[model samples]
Target: MNQDLFDNVRRLVTTAAAGLAARRGEGLAEVLERLAQQDIGPGAFREPEPRSLPVLRHLPQCVGEAMVLDPRLASAIASVEDALQWQQSASYTDDLLGAGFSENYGWAEIIGPRGFFPGDDVLLGLLMLGPERHYRDHYHPAPELYWPLTAGSFWSRDGGPFVEQPQGAIIWHPSMALHATITRATPLLALWCWTRDTATPAQLA
Candidate 1:
């Protein structure tokens, strides 16, 4: 990874990590720290063709609704989606079923054993969602974090009411909690993570 991009990503992760850690918890803070030493988040786009699951088609509905919130972010995600050629894998075909919002939603791996930064057990990605999309209840064993680059997104856990976090806000969910995401404005362009226990994919209720 280029030193400039590396430093930029590190800054984003460190700042985002500290803020999220204070609001969410310590696990996420640690993940950011670990990521600082590796090529995880920003350099994700450094490679022209990185390996990924074959089928990336599962994300359009939920993410599509996000455009109503932030057209710019929606545009960015849409552009990324257009450039991507999905590779089929268990994560696409079998993993995301029952999750809300069918279109305009997408996920790309940034760090993980099979992702941009292989041998880095921690899993991370960029999450794009369209306006008005609701990611219904879901659970996973891995602790998770979200650093929303834009505003107007809501998050909930264990059936809790959705809470709107601000731009640059960090949302964290502990392992196996039933969680969901909803966006009203500024289609989400957020950094996502599963610091550990990434073997278990996300499962929707």
Candidate 2:
């Protein structure tokens, strides 16, 4: 394992947790508490081989935009961007979602089964969506939280109308609640978390 890379990711995770600590949102307190208890040090981390996806092409721009909202968070993300293993859900395909969606969307776990630090029934990661894409309604067993670092994104929950969410905004989804995301004009880079009940994957609604 590259100690430098590992240290960078640790800093990123620490920064993320500190940044989230001050923010107030629905279900955020619970998520923060759970995250605070995790052992993210070297003893608990096992780095996976890094990989990436097409959607990462938008990451630079997303990070640039994010700088306007929170430079500390943006810089932290940029510091370890290359070390993350970006992945997509096997169940998501153009046939099920929409054309081009496969190339335009991906996520990377920072703390979970497939991440640098194995987490227990919890996940903390980043999610990206390229421009002009709609991630239609999907539901999972875990309660979720999203903190978008970029702008021009919209979110919908429980089949409701899409509502624009600004940068640094926290979006929460209770367990099994249908939720969707739409990106317009600009791509999205967001921190996402699942607190407990994480065994089941999300299913399209």
User: Whose lDDT is greatest here?
Assistant: 2
Model 1 whole-model lDDT (C-alpha atoms): 0.60
lDDT (tens digit, per residue) of candidate 2 on 1-205: 6788778888888888888887989988988988987888878978787899999999999999989987888888898888899999999999988999999999999999889889888999999999999999999999999999988899999999999999999899999999999999999999999999999999998
> For each candidate, how many residue pairs have backbone atoms clashing (under 3 Å)?
28, 0
Model 2 RMSD in angstroms: 0.9
| TM-score of every prediction relative to native | 0.63, 0.97
Least well predicted 10-residue stretch by lDDT in candidate 2: 1-10
lDDT of each: 0.60, 0.91
Across 99-174, the per-residue lDDT of candidate 1 in tens digits comes to 4444446666545544435525576667766676777788989888777766788999899999998766667788
lDDT, candidate 1, at 163: 94
lDDT of prediction 2: 0.91
In angstroms, how far off is 21's CA in candidate 1?
A: 8.5
